[model samples]
Structures are given as structure tokens and as C-alpha cells.
Target: MNPFTYARAENAHDAFALGSQPGAKYLGGGTNLVDLMRETIERPVTLVDVTGLSCEIEERAGGGLLVGAAVRNTALASHLAVRTRYPMLARAVSSGASAQIRNMATVAGNTLQRTRCAYFYDDEGSRCNKRNPGQGCDAVDGFNRYHAILGASPGCVATHPSDMCVALAALDAVVHLQNARGERTLPFIDLHRLPEDRPEIETLLEPGELITAIELPPLAFGARSTYRKVRDRSSYAFALVSVAVALELDGDTVKDVRMALGGVAHKPWRAWKAEEALRGKPATAESFRAAAEAELAHAQPLRGNAFKVELAKRTLTAVLAELKEVKV
Candidate 1:
């Protein structure tokens, strides 16, 4: 870790002011940032503590919820409202990290967490474009079973490792952010950038911008939603392929659907094409398979990770099949 100055921010203005300084970084739960610091992957000189600021969940006007950035992952997962209304989110949140870590991890920190790419963390040898732009990527030809299959560029093949973010993308959640200038909102899907030419730029956030809260619009259909993660081991392991499905059924037909995939792309992979294929179609195993296949058709999996394409397809099918049982 680097020698750093620490300041506890009192408000958004204070946080923005403190964060705008050179080599400054906002401190949330310190679950991700702290680890990166110790690894020497991140070396911020100034740490502005924002954990004590705006740490409450607020109910929106239309049955929606505004989750504060500082809200702990455990609190969000176990909150009565989240469990009842956005069960997929609750499930996703609980799927990540451990009880102790979740108790300390914040919602904003989870979204901003870096990729768990091995090369990105190998400070000694590997060349990671995410860690050093124009350095060239080593994961492209390395042991990359966990590398990305979709939205991967030649510059990088890393995947976003946030289970909560996958659910947020499916729910059409909006990210609220603030800076010294003012405030702005972005769709959750747009918040993360693809590992394109500029793999170093992970998100769309401005330098001093801080996430305020995430607003989840009311989704009555989310009552039937669920999140499923498949990994090497059950607990404390990152998803190899995960699916979040929220379906609205009209008898035996699909009325509406929102599907997002994780551990397969630079960002939460929203299966918009698959959702389009399933809507108004008979909610059957064949339809699910076909929908999943339609989305995977565009996936450009690397040599070592081509199996992820089929795994993602099967996972998506199973999630939709499970959702089919939920009474509309």
C-alpha cells in the first residue's frame, strides 16, 4: 500500500472536492479497493472515506427503490423490500463474496469493482491492457478459461465480475452519480464499457464523479425473476456463467422478458436479442433453447473459452425453464 492521506467526507460536495485531487480515490466498503491497494494494482495517494455519507435506502414514488451507494451489500440483500420486489437482485447480491465481506461491501463499490482477471492482478510479469494501456494483452493466449466470450477486443478479454451488476442490467436500473458540477443519471447497462480498443477505461464515470444511488424502476414482472450462477464450486467462487431472468407470462406464452448474462463479457451481457425471440412465443423448453442459441450466435469465444458459449446457452435455458413455473 502507498502512503496516503485519509479524509472522511461529510457530504457529496466534500467527497467530490476531496476526490478531485490527483491520485485520489473514494473509499466505500474497502473490500475491493483495499485489496487492490495491497496488491499494488491500485496506488491512490489520497483516500476519501465516503462510507458514512448517504448510507440509506429510500423508497421512490412509484413503488421503486433508490439504493444508496453506501448501503452495505448484506443490508441490500436482506432488506425486506428488496427480497420481496427484486428477489433476483437479493439473490445475486448474496451469491457474491462471503457473509463477512458482503457485510462490509457497499453497493457502489461492488459496481465499481475491478475485473478478477489473473493477468490484470499479476503486477510482476503479465502484460494487461487494463492495467497498462498499449502494453498488450497476455490473456489472449494464456490460461484463460475465465476470459470473456462476448464484447472482447484484441486489446483485452477480461470479464466484469459483479453478480449484482448482472441483475441491475436486467432490471433496467439507473445509476445516479454526482460530482462537483452537479448530478447525472446513466442506465446501468451503459455504465460499464466494453474492453474495446481502450481497455483501460473500464467505465463511463468522470474523474471526480461518485455514485449516489441506483434506482430500480418498479417491475411487477420481477416477482417471477431469479438469478442462477454456475461456477467451479458453490460458495465464495465467482460465476463461470450466470443468468438473471425476469419473465412475465401470459398463460403459456411469454408476455415480456429481461435476461442478462454475467462472467461472459466486459459488462453484464444483456440478452436483448434472446428476450426479443421469447416474447409472445410459447414458453417451452424448445423456445428457451432457441432464444438462448440466438443470443449465443453472436458470441465470439476464444480458443480456451469456447465452452462458455454452450455453458451460457444451457444456463440461460435452465433459468427460463425455472421461471416458466412461476404463476403469473
Candidate 2:
């Protein structure tokens, strides 16, 4: 970590003032940023602490939930309303990191956590366009089994590593942000950017913009929702292939679906094509399999990660199969 100035914000206004700088990065729980800084990957000369901001839950007029940016991962994931109404989100959060880390990680920082791509942090390699643009990408030819398959350009192939993010994408949550320009709300799907050569720019937020809150509109899909993660380990490891699904069924057919995949794209990969294929179709094992097949028709996997296409499809199929039973 570099010698830096520290400002503990007493309120949102104070936080915004310190945060609205050209190169400022907000410090939430510091679970991810702190680690990256120690490795010298992030060299922010100023750190603005936003932990003092109000961290309470706000209920919207429509029974929706607006979670504070300072809300800890544990609190957001285990809230009575969240656990009972957004079980997919609860499960995703509960499955990540250890209890200790989860207790300190904030929901906002988790959503914007830097990718765990090995190439991005290995200062020695420096081939990650995300870490250093225009140097060239080593992951394009190196060990890329965990790299992206969708929305990837020749410049980068790192996958978004947050399990909670995939769930949020499926749920269509809105992210609230603030900067010198005032406040704005962006859809969860549009918040993050794919590599597209300009891999250094990972999100739509302007520099020094502070994430204020995350709001999830009320949905009745909770009963049929599920989050499934397959990883190298059963406990506390990143997803190898994960699916977050919330499906609405009409008798033996699909009415609506929310499908998002992690570990397969630079951003949360929404399987809209697969959802399109399944809606109004018979909700059966065979139908689920066929939908999975259609989802990967456009997938362009790299040499080491080609198997991810089949694996992701199978994982999603199993999730849908489980959801069908839950819907019943």
C-alpha cells in the first residue's frame, strides 16, 4: 500500500466531496480493494471511507427493497425480507467467501469487486490489458481455463468472479450511483462493461463516482428461484460454472424466466436466447436440455475453456429442473 491521505466521511455529503475526485476510489469493507492495493495493483493516492454512511434498509412503495451501499454482505444476505423473498440472492451471498470476510464485505463493493483473474494481478506478467492496457494479453494464449467466452475481445478474457452479481443480473436490480454530476440509476446489466479492447475501463461509472444503493423490485419468482455454483472446491472458492435462475411456470410450460451465468463472460452473461427458447414451451427435462443447447449456439470458447459451453448448459439445465420441482 502506498502512503495515502485518509478521510473518514461523516455523512453522504462529506463522503461525496472527498469521493468526487479525479482518481479517488471509495473504500467500503476493503475486502477486495485492500488486497489489490497491497499487491500494488491499485495505487490510489487518496482513500475516502464511506463506512459512516447510513446503512439501513429502505422499503419502496411497491414492497421492493433498497439496500444501503454500506450494508454488509452478511446483513443484506440474511435480512428476513431478503432471505424469504430473494432466496437466490441470499444463497449466493451465503455461498461466497468465509463468514469473516462476508461480515466485512459491503454489498456495493461486492458488486464492483475487481475480477480474480490471475493475469490481471500478476504484476510480473503484465499481459492483462485490464492491469496494463496496450501491453498485450497473455491469457489469450496462456492458462485460460477460467477465462471468458462471451462479450470478449482479443484484448481480455477475464470473467466476473462475484456470485452475487450473477443473481442480481437475473433479478434485474438497479444500482444507484452518485458523483459530482449528481445521482443516477443504472440497470445491473448495464453497470459493467465487457473487455472490447478497452479492458481498462471495467464499468460505466465515472471516476470517483460513489455507489449509493442497490434496489431490487419485488418479484413473485422467489419461490421458484435458485442459485447453483459448480467450482473446483465445495467450499469458499470461485465459481467454475454458476447459474442463477428464477422461472415462472404455467402448468407444464414456461411463462417467464430470469437466467444469468457466471464464470463464462467478462460480465454477467444473461442467457436471453435460452430463455426465449423455453418460454411457452413444455417445461420438461427434454425441453430444458434443448433450451440449454440453444443457449450456447453463439458461444465462442477458447481452446482450454471450450468445455465451459457444455458445462454451463448442463448446470443451467439442472437448475431449471430443480426450479420446476420447486414451482410445483
Best by TM-score: 1
Query: CA lDDT of each candidate?
Result: 0.93, 0.88
Q: Give, for candidate 1, the lowest lDDT window spanning 10 residues.
A: 51-60
- Writing each residue's lDDT as its tens digit, candidate 2 over 41-115 gives 998878999898768878887778999999999998889988877888999998888999999999888989988
Residue 48 miss distance in model 2 (angstroms): 0.6
lDDT by residue for model 1 over 1-328, one digit each (tens)?
Answer: 6799999998887888899889999999999999999999999999999987777888999899999989999999999999988899999999999999999999999999999999999989999999999999999999889989988999999999999999999999999999767999999999999977999999999997999899999998888999999999989999999999999988899999999999999999999999999999999999999999999998898889899999999999999999889765
Stretches of candidate 2 off by over 4 Å are none
Candidate 2: pairs in clash: none
Predictions: Cα RMSD each: 0.8, 1.2
Model 1 ranges with Cα > 4 A deviation: none
